[model samples]
Target: MARPVPAGTARADDITAKARIRNAALELFARDGVEGTSLRAVAAAAGVTVGLIVHHYGTKEALREAVELAIVERFADAIASVPLDSRPAGRIAAARDEAVADMLAASPAIVDYLRRALLDGGGEQGDLVSRLSQLSAQQVHDLRAAGVASTNHTVGEQVLTIMVRQFGRLFLQPLVDRISHEFPEDIDPSRTPPRLTVELALDASRADDRD
Candidate 1:
């Protein structure tokens, strides 16, 4: 059970309304996109006046930025919570998948938002991709340090591969489901079958040893 807020001031209500407006905009932007969505539409959906949104966020771009930052933070928080103390590659993969699933369950809109961001090509996509690649590269470095991954593989290429596997798998899920019969959304990332990450790591290790 959650604790109730203390006997309230208008501040709490104002915060709640602001959140509602954002949530409404999030849904609209996720579905219709930023270019397609309007302050009027968001206001209608949120059951608030357009002036209220303007008062809180000032501009649509600001509101969109806020939503994007919130989504990124949520993903970061989820991934950050995964236990990195384990050295086993499989365990690491499982933990990552668990975190992904948990975050998606809580905020399914994130998937739509990310997929659009990639496909539609706007809203800090380049920065987001760069951030994701950097994070993936660091994870690869950690796995290599743990002796569970191949040090021979360049972190750059590994990050690219991971990004494709992660986002491609997400954005093209319907087709993947049809052909591959794998639904990442339905199963935990860890519960799903082992993938190219382990194979690439093993290959790298083998190549290095042969040298």
Candidate 2:
């Protein structure tokens, strides 16, 4: 008969196993999409049994939620890191640039996840929408405190517009790729490059104030 494993050893194994599953799920889902991928496929990619995947995640929906939460947390952390104390307009511009760059670096998987969430219109999409709304409110508050313009549009409206633009850029990678070819480094988020979206948004906001 085999002897029982120590508690610490069992815990470590659990952690490693869960991490493996998550990493594999992320890769497969990124390449194959959420609906296209399967629990068995995820298990195969992770080099584990299907039962193990089920045991950890309980269901495909749970796994999807896990992935979405992880991605959102990374984005939130990235946005939070930007220094907001500078000139409002400049700071917002810088923050948006950095946020995009950070998201790009975090993983292309996030774009895939967003695409599914937007198209599916489920609990996951609702959760992400709510989180984004909160982020937008914070951004508006920061802008107002810094004395940036756009006093006419409510914070919710501005936030929703920005979120929509972000979703468009994220899901429509082909467009971004074509634009990148023309602008070269300017459109590439990896380089924290200048984004036309950011510039246009800021310009529009300022224009609103002017008019």
Candidate 3:
């Protein structure tokens, strides 16, 4: 038998219910894709009434938008959490550690959602790509201003380089894991590095100041 909710907890329960619906939708959408998922199915998966799902989000598209915003906010928060003054390697180590921690705690559905969103080439995907590219370019600008990164490459090139390095893990983890499986765990480069990560910046001091 289920326990009854205490009196005066309706607001809290409502909040919980909304979150549950959102999470359930994310999982289902990742598995079934947005075109294949339905509100009734999401409500059933979330243990809520279909009416409640509608009450929280007017439509499935709204719910998906909410999920997309949450994902983008999470990535922004992760980047913002690192300090600007830290050494390049230290900053990367902190960001990497935070990312690993998030990965461990995050639902696999989130990863699936991102993969689907990018691969499906949804209309919003262009915006997502643009945002990430701008962010990468900003990071390159900061690093170069601080004398940590090379200025040999243009901002566009820097963005592309960083994006490839950053997003590659998300898109190609399975391939990397398979190829690295034969290697001993002790020296497997796929594994997270020690706390003090090596500097990824090129030696700007020696490079020509072209860009």
Candidate 4:
């Protein structure tokens, strides 16, 4: 009873459909672990047919990789905004806070996604590690320029330690309750603000520079 759609119109519709599926998958993958989400679920969430999801992303792993790419791209953009030319510790701290805040505000789902990845050790862990390494190198460069304490440990180590602590307190642990559940004896989230932790770390790093 319905007339056939034109070739151009059908192609455009297909593109729109694919985009919707990808966006919906990103949200689901960010909130729920990839292993927990299925293609039918993604298709239903996106208001598309399961066939469309397969047409756009042939497999669940491909869909997840796309989601990871989007998340990492957004995070990297935020981090790139950090001022590299300023005093090291101050700049690194400010940049870190900005990136965290941006992630919290712009992509709250990503915090959950990151928490899952960090705790479960799944989905682009290598990419996350690489990014942290790069950020740590940046921090070391900043610290040296700012006259903060010089350390014999490699920048990668310093960055990994700082990143793990910061992410654990601010993002990962709070998102999933992993730390609280695993270590009840540890500091509770209600007892301390994350900013205080950052301040303490910043102060310790710059202790020698102070009068």
Candidate that would win on lDDT: 1
Question: Model 2, range 1-211, lDDT digits (tens) per residue?
Answer: 1122222211133458776677667666766677888888887767788899889899998987777566666666666666555445645644664576656545655666666666765654357666666766786777677676366766766676667656655656567667668966455456754343421244553543420
Candidate 4, 146-194: lDDT as tens digits: 6652564556556655565456555533534553566666756677532
How large is the C-alpha RMSD of every model relative to the true structure? 8.2, 8.1, 7.2, 9.2
Candidate 2 vs. truth: CA RMSD?
A: 8.1
Better of 3 and 4 by TM-score: 3
- Pick the winner on TM-score between candidates 2 and 4: 2
Instruction: Return the TM-score for each candidate structure.
Output: 0.65, 0.65, 0.65, 0.61
Better structure of 1 and 2 per lDDT = 1
Model 1 poorest ten-residue lDDT run? 1-10
Model 1 whole-model lDDT (C-alpha atoms)? 0.64
Ranking by lDDT: 1, 3, 2, 4
Local distance difference test, per candidate?
Answer: 0.64, 0.63, 0.63, 0.60
- By TM-score, how accurate is candidate 2? 0.65
Q: How far is 157's C-alpha from truth in model 1 (Å)? A: 2.4
The order by descending TM-score is 2, 1, 3, 4
